[model samples]
Target chain A: MNWFLKGTLTATLLTMGGVGAMAAPGVTEDKIVLGAVDPLTGPPSLLGKAHSLALKVWQEDVNARGGINGRKVEIVFEDDGYVPARSLQSLKKMVEVDDIFALIGTSGSSQLAAMMPLIDELGIPALNNMAVNSHHFNPPLETLFVVGPTYCQELAAGMTYLVEELGLKDEKYAIAFQDDEFGDDVRCGYLAGVEKYGLDNVLELEFKRGQKDFSAEMLKARAAGVTVLVSGGVVAEHSTLLKEAAKNRMDITFLGAHSAHLTPVQALAGSAGDGYYAADYVPALTSLQVPGVARFMDLANKYLSESEMDSLNRYALSGYAGAMIFEHVMTECGEDLTRACVIEKMEGLDGFETDGLLGPVTYGEGVRHAPTGIMVLQSNAEDKTFSIVSERMEVE
Target chain B: MDYFILLTVSGIAIGVIYGLIGMGYALIFKATSVVNFAHGEIMMLISYMAFSIASSWTLPFWGLLLVCVFISAIVGLVIERVFIRPMLGQDVFSTVMVTIGLAVMIRAVVVLIWGADPLLLPTDIGDSGVEFGMVFLYTSQLYAIGLLAFCVLGMWVFLRFSRMGVAMRATAARETTALLMGINVTHVYAIAWAIAAVIAGISGVLLGTIYGLGPDLWTQGLRAFPAVILGGLDSVFGAAISGILIGVLENLSEGYIGQGLKEISGFLVILVVLMIRPYGLFGTPEIERV
Candidate 1:
């Protein structure tokens, strides 16, 4: 018994020694390589360029600080043009050919859906660039990491604010959503909100992707006496609908998902978008205290063109947050980091705060989703700026 | 009562613009058995051109509108000379397929140059709400509807009496026979495209006033397709009338249904009409030789 106990102790020490042994270059010894794919020249290219810029800013800042514990971090990006097939091809090349340590940011829900299986099979950690579907955080896989608020949560928050906070409970509400899974997720949340409030006042409408004319949809809303409009669509459709509605003089209140409240929509809608309300996950750029934003403003002024400086959209913040998390995880992993160690360290993170742009980021055994919820913004049409209507709320 | 009138009048106004644009489709199809899928893009481009000429050159609306129409006609001639001209002797199916490709290319070029952001065309015609007793009308709506009527009448006169228009009709009826009779069939083809482009330019200016100018405006071409198809692919007058009909029907359906059937009601109408008429309301009856 004494001999066996001695032998067991000796074996344990050898195993520990083996793990500590550094024969080859450690992951954080000289450089850490990461890959990202974005749509640089597609319909969503505006969002893509913003995300890539955010990634660059984060990487530059990290390198300036001596990078993840005295090592440089390198980011390689490929333009996917928002095509799912191309996104999958680029992701495969990033993993198999380039052999990136991990994928930091990817764009689009459909593009992510196409690459999800391969992402799981490769066991590579991916911080989603734009996939905000709730299922991304649910049944959390070891290889997947989501950094944004889910559409379900965002929509629910919008609904709650309209019903509980704004006293729009008795108002006749109508929903116009894109006819797809992303749209379905929003409709599900909307319906769930109506049931929870028991308002007995709801209208639902769906438009196919790329549909322009919404006269029929607007007419139906007018007929139903819909006073509150909830839209889950992109900018082009949103702007078109708003203009059409104004032409008919509906005078309805609008509540839009994040995708609908872009700069293009704001510009097109102009004065008609005065009272428009939208829920966002990231803090506004106009806020004073966000740590990195001020720095970003300085860098943007110094580096980015004047035209690009003012046009920065939501993707810019999300992209920067993604890079911030990547830096945090890599730094925490230390010099002798492996894929497993990186995952372990990232999973253990709690109260992960950024320059106050995002709420506290938390990921662990039971909790995988990180976002705190909606930051309600109302358009000040006269000023052409969004004003914070409600403090950031954690709806979920 | 207020909402109903508002919805009805606005619907009719938009439908008028659609009808005017739909007339281009009918005109091109009437002259050549080809459906111009790029019609909306052409209209969108002309509107952009008009905006550029007016804003950049500081020309008045009347001058800009006339120049825009002339430039659109030239563009139509060039498109015929380059893309459609080469496919004259090819199968009609292949020729029709080229327009689809042309539509995509136009949209890409537009986005590349202007980006995907929407641009509003500022028109001072009707800036305020004009109350007509109990109903209210925007000056812009009045302009759109009035312009639509004028374009419709112009198309009627051109097709009904002009010598060149008569030659176009002869070529449309029988390209082979017209060619044999030394009717300058090529000129007729070019003329048809030019006329179609003018209609598209007028519609574009009208629509830009109502919906703003954007790259995605090509979808309007698809939306207006059902109107032309239902009206009669070969009848210019029918296409114009059906455009207004479809627009009004869509709004009325939405106002009454409250479930969003207005969006697809035009397509539904096309489906039902196709099943019943097969050749459309004014389309030439197919005489199949078994």
Candidate 2:
């Protein structure tokens, strides 16, 4: 070979080796920095604040334990204010400026949908426990790991329990849902249950997203002789639906998704809020009997203020669980942490337990969605709390 | 048949609340020639004020309603003096923009104070309400309908006979002429704002009781806008009747169609009405819209 050709080969090999050995961004020998995008301001801050607080508790606890595998975990949060456009902006800032190794919180459903393209392009490991949509993992991004069941899966499991276990197989069912993507996911589950059990579905009602009144919807439900109702409402809609049904003096069994598992639902529905069901993957905050919940409560009490403790909800439990999963993957990666290593460890999560805080997380090979099993919870209006009413149920 | 009766009654109940909000909008426009874009936020602020009052001190519904009237009156007067009063001689468009800015501020302040969680107004009436045959209405809802009637009658009587009412009508007609005729045009504007604030307070407290109070409760103001435009923006009585008409139409459409049509049903009717009348159902071409 010519002298110039030999030197060119040596230089090219050195450049390839240097590119291969470069350390991951947002990671140092003594620290691992992650990013969180949430609706930290505005009205939806209720969810974001609680999630951020729980993650704070996790961070303090991890560092107090001499750090996870000898690297202190640091998280930088950007408020998306529950807007889709703001979510993409927040994610971009976190990637370019914060240089985050992973994302721990992905705002609301539609908000996260806005950030997916960038998430894929950046190949950043994202642990999503706040909002789980089917589209989030159907095509499957390489580094995004979802830690909970989609609204479809939760509602379907809830319907199954209502039909098979609750002995309402012959009862007529109906659904009052919104007219958007989350609502469509809910309808998918309700229809799935109808098709699987051959149950009679009398009416399928759709309403606007922020609609408050349901008098007409309830009257139509009454006209259809609906005995079982599935609600696809987000927050106040569930309470308002219950209130409207009570006003119409309808004897109906209502079931909803995880969003219904909130104290304000009972508070707004007054006495009419009693005895409704919510399907969720995480145990309720009031479920102190669970070992994981007990541990989380202890840490939260030890770390959070009185008002912050009061703000703890199902979202907090899920956030802590996400932190646990992230810590597990990070530890498994040992001192040689990288985005690809975390992705591999997360994908191989098989029945990893959160001690009853969440259902067993089992993301089989090539699957990004770790659909932990869903459980049914019944509301008690008097106390404004929920108790587990059904065993863990899996979505098919 | 029973279902229709129930839906109609419910629609009218909700419509009465909207009419109350629309009355505020109509009252401000009749007196100031500028739409108070912050009218719904005015209701929300007062309702949250009532919530705070009730939560802090255990007061009966009547007692709470009375306190809210006083507080809302002060709020309206202050808002008129501080915000709207400054833009008095400016173009109507600038005054409307000021109201819009006031609206954004009031909404943000409400969320900041009350937080974003939905709250139930504590009440002695409870949720079962009064049931007449197949129809059921909350005590607050029944009060909502009664209050609308009382407001319309009181407004009609006051505007027809009272000296202040004559002054208000003159000011609404021509501020410069009213000023020249020693009518105290600014005082008329203040009185108009105060009365509108009282009506909004009543509606706010009642609606909060029925629907459960939240930060976005101000959106109901926008919902009542069609009532204002559909009835004649300058005609308070027309706004009330149009509110009822729109509410009933929304409920009936939702009942019959069942595909989220209720949200746009009122707007659709308003579109048809505007296309036909050009200046709303009751608005006059040159003057005397009231």
Candidate 3:
């Protein structure tokens, strides 16, 4: 085993030396491959698997319509299992082994941060995905594009509505965030929004991912008499928070991050989600009024089970929308199918709309951020469904 | 102050689950002297089975729990026969490795079957908060605590009075002497695993209700390890008590110190406990031949 490992390592190094002079290790004619490394088998696998499946569906749909202008778009997906080291390894394999046109729909900030140097060196036209970190926006790369609103924009929209529109400018609020990059971005957004609006009455608490109990955190919020609670964590943590608050009979309203808008929340939180709210970039799955979303629901029914269809989760819709964006970008590139042409067309697209999955994605000078619209969803216990209580509002 | 109580209750609820599983670990170690590293995986697998039987087949919770326990017991027997039985005379390291491998295999099989997506397992115990003076408690939390208490009493009584339990104790006391006295050590080992599996099933189901079913459930095995060690690997009651202690301690640390200290604090307590009492708080001090 030792001898074999050594020989393989030597071969890999020799191959790298030979291939390093090329544009990338694995670009080929008649096919443009992309890599998607995300957690598909670990704790956060829910998000990764959903994103992958959405990408799959989109790619199939595009292929059926003549394959990205006659050049097939294939994605060589790698499961990073939500770790930085694993993500780096997968990114290397994707760039070296199954080289493709560009990468899209990656998950997690830390995972993306690990691949930043490679992305910069390769000058790859990478999408920021649904990661929502501020680093993706700061000192922006010429080849990178953010197809969704940044965490700051999303949080600003939520807080702006609460402060200016809802007449809750002076309302007592508490922020509970995960202790990670994503959480920091959320806090930054909230802080910026509060200052911009000159709003007062806010407190902050933080929790780590995979930490189940949140009683002490909730107690501090309770002591402060917080009316609104914002959390930057996943479904499990939110559910535990809701259950604990319900136990304490606290009248505080819960606000979840975009990622926590999931199917499991309803069951996990149970009655604790009676009046919970979340800020969403896309229309709620419960909204059948939108044409594109109606079509999406119909397609989901045909392809997936009702149980499998977490129609309310903005992530799934975002996943589906991401696939659509790739298709549109490929079409704009025409028959040339080169990475440069695709990037040129993508950066040139102004006010590109997606029938309400998002408002418009326009990449231009001093305007790399896209889709600043957010809607607030309130959980209704009587029907066991979340209803959009506020209309879509634009950020700035 | 109010928040502290809330955190303590929530922590205790989760601690009860750890205590129950830790009890299973301690019980198995006492009788067979083999650490069942796969206990959490077994529990998760049995919970999935219960979901299939209860929700899919429409069995009631009570009926599902009973059927799940029976199936888990059989699975425990099969594991011992196939894995542990082969390493009867082997060193302790070999047995431990086999169980670790078995843990990996169980998690892999589960992922393959379940497709690595988180599954929702809604408990039928009514989702209303019970008011207790100033504090509120989820029905599931109360249900979990009640179940833990029942299991602790049941285990205590069984070990004190039951013939099979007494035989298991005898085997643990002196394997060669018990064999010479006509006690079937093999049966004792199988029973130990069986009992452990039942307790694990309860923990799995409760945890599923609290936190949805996912492939990451195996991490609980690692988290439960500290509790088992702290309570003494061979002391069943000690394991249960320490599980709660660790759980409460973790929450308190996170609550007071802040900055995501629950995970670190739990391990810190384990380290401190080990340094002070090498054999664990309640672990039987072994008298080595050397």
Model 1: residues >4 Å from true position, as ranges? A1-29, A248-251, B1-7, B48-63, B122-138, B258-260, B286-290
Report the poorest 10 consecutive residues by lDDT, candidate 3 chain A. Answer: A19-28
Model 3 chain B: ten consecutive residues of lowest lDDT: B114-123
Say which candidate scores most in lDDT: 2
Best by TM-score: 2
TM-scores of all models?
A: 0.90, 0.95, 0.88
Q: lDDT per residue, candidate 2, A1-396, as tens digits? A: 335634754565477576477667788888888999988777788788889999999999999998867989899999898999999999878866777889999999889899888888768899889989888888888888888988888999999999888998999899999999989999999999999899999999998887878888999999999999999998899999999888888999999999899888899998899999999999898899999999999999999999889788889999999999999999999998989899889988888999998888888676988888899999999998899999998767
Quality of candidate 1's docking, in CAPRI categories?
A: acceptable
User: Model 3 Cα displacement at A208 (Å)?
Assistant: 2.7
Give the higher-lDDT candidate: 1 or 2: 2
Second chain TM-score per prediction? 0.94, 0.96, 0.95
* lDDT tens digits by residue: candidate 3, A127-195: 765676657656666666776666667777777767776677777877888877777777876887778
The 10 consecutive residues of candidate 1 chain B with the worst lDDT sum are B120-129
> How well is each residue in B32-125 modelled by candidate 3, as lDDT tens digits?
8888888888988887776666667765556667787889889888988998988898988899899889988998888767655556665566
Model 3 pairs whose backbones collide: A33-A100, A219-B3, A247-B136
Q: State residue B217's C-alpha deviation in candidate 1, in Å.
A: 1.7
DockQ of 2: 0.71
